[model samples]
Target chain A: MEFVVFIIAGLLAIIGALGLIGFKNPVHSALSLVLSLFAVAVLFLNQDAQFLAAVQVIVYAGAIVVLFLFVIMLLGVDQAEDLSVEPIAGQRPIALAIGAGVLALSVLFISVAADGGATGQQSVTAEKVDSITGTAQSATAALGDNQTDGTETIPNIEQLGRTLFTDYVFAFEVTALLLTIAVVGAVMLARKPKGELAPLPVIPGRSGTTDETEELEDA
Target chain B: MELTSTWYLVLAAILFALGATGLLVRRNPLIMFMCVELMLNAVNLTFVTFGNDLNDLGGEISVFFVLVVAAAEVVIGLAIIVAIMRRRNEATADDLSALRG
Candidate 1:
């Protein structure tokens, strides 16, 4: 059952990525990206990174992609891009060659890893044993019965939160600062230039209705 | 055969390659931005896979930071793109060759 699910999710992810590249319309590509992101989130769930999966869906698919679409619509740049123009000479051929090389190298490295040693499950089990032993001693010393066992391991979210707040506190706080600066910068960049004159109140003298004139003025 | 971390890592690498290709192939700035997001997602997958493989929370925590950074990047990047598009009526990256000497 798990294998079947993995296969399905992986297929969806790859298909979505292909669609992202294949589609001519930017809106279609954005939608395809959402599909890819959601599929990856499912894979994350399968890997037991529930928190990361939820964050991936909420922040990435929900917020960031939505922002992309909003910009697309606002700019009215949704028209299909002209494919014939190679504005940058010889870019596509080079990109394709490099992309192929990267894929080959990555696959080769993975195959050569650890002499085709233990499967993922074996490595995970071994790591779990090591962690349990290592944490049992320290965690037991600090928190007594809060110690974790193999079967009763702390949930991924809880572990993530504990680590973020304690071990990675500085990095987490820096992320908050970064987000604040980004928000400020985005607002500054997206806002209309301050010196631009506000549209005059619709003096209904000339052509179309008050609404049309207001629209014209705004434009 | 059972699925393993290697499988996920390989899948991520493929996705990353596709993203890089798309970034280079697509001339539209918006599409290139989407490709960048794709690459970031691939990296996120790798981090989670390693976190699971190592039985440690460090990878996951790093993923959180990456997410934050990605979000920040998206906002700033899109804002820049929109500003450029508004001035020029299109967002093709190749057309923005003002810096070309």
Candidate 2:
């Protein structure tokens, strides 16, 4: 079952990714990206990351891609792009070669490394800990997880909430600040310029357009 | 065959490569941004897979942060794009040189 799920989701993700790049229309690309996002979300669930899977769908597929489509329409840039006009000769082939190189390098690294390079994070609270070395010390215990002594697993959302509020509370608060800054920046950027775009003064002797515009306003 | 974390990692690498190629090849700013999202999602997948393999909560928590950051980034980026697009309806990534001065 797990293998079947992985294969299907993985294939869907690759297809969506290809559609995102292959489509000439930005809207179509955005829509295809939605497909890819959904597939990733499914994979998230397969990993038992239930909360993240929901966020992946809600935030990524629901919000981000929608924002892309909204912008595509609002800017009136939905028309099919003329992809044939490649000003730089051989840029596509070169970029494709670089991409293939990157893929090859990562695949080689993954294949050569033992256990896919995972550190086998230590679940210190567990009764019989694995002999594998890990960086975490009392991390699982520190999170107030009830699963330490009980056979029952702590709910995914509860575990995440505990971690966010306890261990990384400061970082969580910082995200609020980051979000506020982003909102302000977006509003400022989206706002229209207050006045006309006057041409720069031709000669320095004129003392500049700033003075000219002010004088005109005064008049 | 059992599904291992390595399978997911390899798939993510493929997704990341595709995104990189699109980012390099596509001249449209919006399309480039979409490609960037693709790469970000690929990283998110890798993080989740590792988290599962390690039986760690840190992976999902890190993904939470990433999602927040991605959201913030998109907001600012789209606003800038909108600002630029309003100035000239048919602006491509290359035309951004107008701001160089």
Candidate 3:
């Protein structure tokens, strides 16, 4: 059942992504991107990362894509000319060959790696616990308690928050600073210019050309 | 019928490839930006899949960071686009060759 849910979510995400790439209109593409982001958030929720999933929905689907739409609307670029540049005739074959070669090499690597013995599935679960808790102490406590009760225990959001504020505070502050810089930069870039670069050109028949026009008419 | 999570990863990879191709081929800046977003979401899907597959929370946390960064990128990217559109009426990526300055 969980696997089925994952499959559905993945399929929806892929379909939305396809739409995002295939759509010619910017607004439609942004909407499809939203759908894809939402699907990924659902997958995050299924992974037991409730807080992350909520943040995903809020940040990606709610805020970011809406910003894109707003800019698209504001710019009023509805009549965009199609400007897809096809690869030069000779370059296409070379590019295709390189891509194929890379794919083949990756396939060969994966096949060889898959044949190796699965030495560390259990270790992965252990490592997952440590990384999720963001500390050895909490993970140990969680595991110790779980082992005593013979039940699986997942760390909740509060523990995650504690770690974020305590150990990861510097990183969090850095992210905040980066966001502030981005916002300020965006605002500055989007600000209207105070002056024109050049004076408007005087039209031949307009803009105080009436005397000349009358003389020409009389002649 | 049990489908493996690897199948989802494969699908995500295909979507990512499509988005990358669009980004490379499309000369419209807006479409390129949209394709970039598509690629990011594809990566997010892959992260979520691995999170579930490994029963790991870190992957999801990473996804959160990815979302935040992607949002920031879109905001700044759109601002840049608006600036470019204002300076030059054209939004085609090819016209941006003025960046050679």
Among the numbered candidates, top lDDT falls to: 2
What's the number of clashes in each of the models?
0, 0, 0
Provide the clash count, candidate 2: 0
- Using DockQ as the measure, which candidate wins? 2
- Which 10 consecutive residues of model 3 chain B have the lowest summed lDDT? B92-101
DockQ list for all candidates: 0.47, 0.58, 0.42
What lDDT does the true structure give each of the candidates?
Answer: 0.79, 0.83, 0.66
lDDT of 1 by residue, A127-147 (tens): 666666554223223444443
What's the candidate order when arranged by decreasing DockQ?
Answer: 2, 1, 3
Q: Write the per-residue lDDT of candidate 2 for residues B1-101, one digit (tens) a residue.
A: 97878899999999999999999999999999999999999999999987777676778888999999999999999999988787666777875654333
- Superposed on the true interface residues, model 2 gives a C-alpha RMSD in angstroms of 5.5
True contacts kept of each: 0.66, 0.74, 0.42
Window of ten residues with lowest summed lDDT in model 3 chain A: A198-207
- By summed lDDT, the worst window of 10 consecutive residues in model 1 chain B runs over B92-101
For candidate 2, the TM-score is: 0.85
TM-score of each: 0.84, 0.85, 0.76
- Ranking 1 against 2 by TM-score, winner: 2
